[model samples]
Target: MEGLVDINRLASGEAGRALLERVFQDDSERFLRRLRDRVDRVGIDLPAIEVRYQGLSVQVDAFVGSRALPTLWNSATNFLQFD
Candidate 1:
């Protein structure tokens, strides 16, 4: 959350996952703010990134989508849902 947080550029899904965990842990409030801002900008009707992140997980299971936390970890493919 300091410079740029492009999940796409990460070495792997595990790396991405670890980075996310770090960001979320460092400043959950700020992270949530950014997520909320992103969702707002994207014009998602759901209005909650936590929900989307939670529901989209196959490998990276989400514990509490509203809380913005990752659960299970499999791989980047499953993590990002590239298929």
Candidate 2:
């Protein structure tokens, strides 16, 4: 897999209640290790990405089905929640 699996593709609308699921059903340890490695590469320097906010806005969500992007609950009005 080139990227992480989108769990919302399962479309249950809730998170963290399942003890196990289809995602990571095979080789979860390797999957998680890869995940950690990917995460480690992000945001090492704050100033490097400060301009990212200059042209940003909340998404209008025109897609009707599963999105490839794992959409977070973004707060259009709350800057603190951007994390």
Against the true structure, whose lDDT is highest? 1
Looking at model 2, report the run of 10 residues with the lowest lDDT sum.
Answer: 73-82
lDDT of 2 by residue, 34-80 (tens): 87777678735333444345667786634334433345533332334
* Model 2 global lDDT (CA atoms, 0 to 1): 0.52
Give candidate 1 misplaced runs (Cα > 4 Å): 1-26, 47-83
Could you tell me every candidate's TM-score relative to the true structure?
0.26, 0.21
lDDT of 1 by residue, 30-53 (tens): 888899899899988873355335
- After TM-score superposition, the amount by which residue 54's alpha carbon in candidate 2 deviates from its true location, in angstroms, is 43
The candidate scoring highest on TM-score is 1
> Any idea what lDDT model 1 has?
0.67
